[model samples]
Structures are given as structure tokens and as C-alpha cells.
Target: MAVHSPTSGPCRSIVVSKLVAPATRRSLENMSRRSGVDLFFSSTLSSAELTDRAAVAVVVPVPHAEDEVMEMVHRIRELAPTILLCGVIDVPDQSLWLFAERNGFNLVSSAGGIGAALSRRLAADDLGVREPIAVLNSSDIAGRLGLLGEFEVEGCSVALWRGGGRLGCLENRCTHSGAKLSEGEVEDGVVTCPRHGSRFDIVSGERVRGPADSDVKHFDVFEREGRVWIVPEP
Candidate 1:
């Protein structure tokens, strides 16, 4: 299933592998058409000839064996460390999902869920073009002592905290496994991920511990007229 959309530009490219189901392939193709994304469908992960031009790949293993899945993921990661990886599984299971996450696959989801997930990752850069959203009121955030509150800005989850009389805001998703940082404990200007205990400096969004090699996304926060506002991406 090689689809060349007229809208396919250099901005985004996607390679989909191991999706044998005709319906699944067609669904992804339809999504690519609607979103104007470049779509390349391949039969196997190893055979998929991806170049630096490719941005991400959706991998679906035909076999449910844990070993096979792990091997495929390992191969893909070895071949393309910079390319974002997403796994599409037919059934929802905890063990397999955790295996994918622990191996550094950015997202793992059911076949029915991959289209939306891929779309979100593809459009992530468009956040910079959108307007800043007002998250909460300063008065509403004041007097929280340590953890101020959590809010959503333009569909992006954000966590707010105040330490040493200075307010800080960061993307709620943990850099390690996308856990909600708001659910984790905050201490000494660092927030820990509840899932893996990855700590991040709330002020700079820098990773302070293991398992998270990247920094969490930081949002510019400011107060205007008694309200707190956030620029989703900078």
C-alpha cells in the first residue's frame, strides 16, 4: 500500500509496516489522505527501507509471540534511533505494552487507536503556530503551597507548581513513559514521574534522573490581569 498524496510534503513522513489486514491499511491510508501526510506501507519491519526523510513509522507485528515482538522493536530502534516509533497491537495486554514502552517505542496502542495517535504526533509541530491559551487564574493558583494545580492548554496537559514564590509550568506528560507528572511528588524544584520515578527540574524541564533521556516539554507561563496563561510550545 504505497500512497502518494499530493499534500505529502517534506514536513512529515510516515512508514507503516506489518499491517496485513486490508481494512487496517485502508484506514491508515484514509487518515493520511485526510491529514495530507506522506504514507509508505511495508510488509515487514526489516524490509522497510526508511531514510532520513522519514519522520515516524507505525509497526504492527503479525505474530503475537513476545520474543518476536521484542526482536522486531529492537531491530527498528537499532536501525533508526531518531525516527519516532509507534506500535499497533490488535489486543490490549499489559505485559506486551510495557515491553514496548520500556524499549523506547514512543507510543503503543490498539490498531483502532493508531490513526489518531499518529495524527497527533504528526501535528505536534503545529502547536507553535497556534495562539496561546489561558490556563487558569492566578488567584485560583495562589496559596497552593507546593503543587499549585494542573490544567490543560489547547489539548496539552500541563502541570503548575510554585516554589520559592516563583510559578513554573511544564507539560504534564513524563519524558520517560508519558505518565502524568502532576500525579507525582514535587520536592526541591524537581518533579518525579510516578510510573518510573524519573525526576525533572520543574523550572527548566531538564531530566534529573535515569530512564528519561530527553527533557520534558516546557511551556512559557505568565500572569496577565489576575490569570495564568501558557504558550503551549516555544
Candidate 2:
């Protein structure tokens, strides 16, 4: 949020879990000074620290691999579900926000976009936001099982794919231009964007072709008793 008088501030607490970039670190530190929030930096977070300090949000940078970031999110959720989780990426990829949200993160913004997200979150934060697990049936979809399929999960567009003897679900928007991935072609476990020829792997959510800014999000698909279940987390 913006700067406020100390006496009339919400006095929020946000922790920087792993910020190594100089520019982003400076930007956030300056904002924290002006906003009157208890923003601080720490590499490690114990259960006691989270509970004793009353941290409202945790800022984690996605480095090395996205899987490591996901692990941290799960750990934070287990320690305290009410604390908001924010994931920071290297580039500006607004398209991955849904993917981040679906996987237990409250907000996922690029290095440049984190400020806006933090401002909005601190201004109007929620401690108990959650979505129930969603379910779909194999017989309900009106297409071949191996073809690309679209559905809704936690109010976000999701695409289901069954190919190469493998089954999985993924976010339906391209990270490059926000194009509908369902309109594209899925072959050999890769989804190609119809507009710009960008390709992404449905299984790992990695960008396989360019003109694509970043990779999409993936969800695990479990099939049993003629029904398909898609979990929000991958």
C-alpha cells in the first residue's frame, strides 16, 4: 500500500524470503519504508518466527527451478495457511498469475510487477481464502480423450490432455500473448499456440518454442472409476 500515517496504518508484516537482485531488493525496501509496514528480509523461516512475528505475506523469488519454489509454498502453507504467498519471477509474465494462484500462491508477479501486487494485497488482504477441489468426468467432455480439452478449475481456465499414454491438465493460456491454448494443436505432449507459433510442454509446463515469453502452469490428472480429477497444484 501507499504511505500512511503511523497512527492510521494497518501496520502489515511482509517477509522477503529470498531476494538476491539488487534492484528489486532496493525497490521493495524503499516501499516498505514509505508504506509503514514491517517489511524485513530473512533467508530462513521457522514455525515459531511466522507465528510470533505475525507475518501477513511472504515474498519468494522463483530461482533455479520452479519446482523448488512450489515446495517452499507448500511448506509455508503447512506452517500457516492464513499467510499470503507471493511468487516472484525473473521476467514480466502476467499470464502465469492464474497458475500461481491455483497452486496455493495468493499472487505471482514478475520482478517489475511485484510492487503493484504487494500494494493491492496489503491494502486488502485475506487470511482465509481457499477453493474446494474440482472434479470432471471422462464421459462429460465432448471430445476425444487424447485431444485438447478445456474446463474450469477454481474459476480459472484449464486444459486437459491425454496423449502418448500420459494424462495431465494445464493452464489454457499462452504466457506469450495470452492466446487461448485450446484453439491450438496438442501433439507429442506439446501445445502449440495458434497465433504466434509458441509451444509449451503439457507435462512440465516448459516453453518449448519461442515467441513465447514463459512457460504455462500444469496440474496433475487422476483417473479412476470413469471420472477424472484435477488438482489445483501440480
TM-score of each: 0.48, 0.47
Q: The CA-based lDDT of model 1 is what?
A: 0.66
Q: Which stretches of candidate 2 lie over 4 Å from their true place?
A: 1-11, 64-66, 92-98, 126-234
TM-score, prediction 1: 0.48
lDDT of each: 0.66, 0.65
**Quick one: how many clashes does candidate 2 have?**
0
In the range 1-234, model 1's lDDT, one tens digit per residue, is: 346422345555577774545555666776777887667666654433554344455456434776776577556644554455677766657777765654446667666667777678657754123245677787876677567778877778889887644456889999777899988888877888999999887766778896989988776555666776665652
Q: Per-residue alpha-carbon lDDT of model 2 for 1-234, expressed as tens digits? A: 333222234454677765546655666676676666666566676665454334666787754445665577668755655556777776655545544554457677766667666876776644323322446676775355555468888778988886544565778888988898888887877778899999887766778899987889876555545666665641
Q: Where in model 1 is the C-alpha error above 4 Å? A: 5-11, 44-48, 125-234
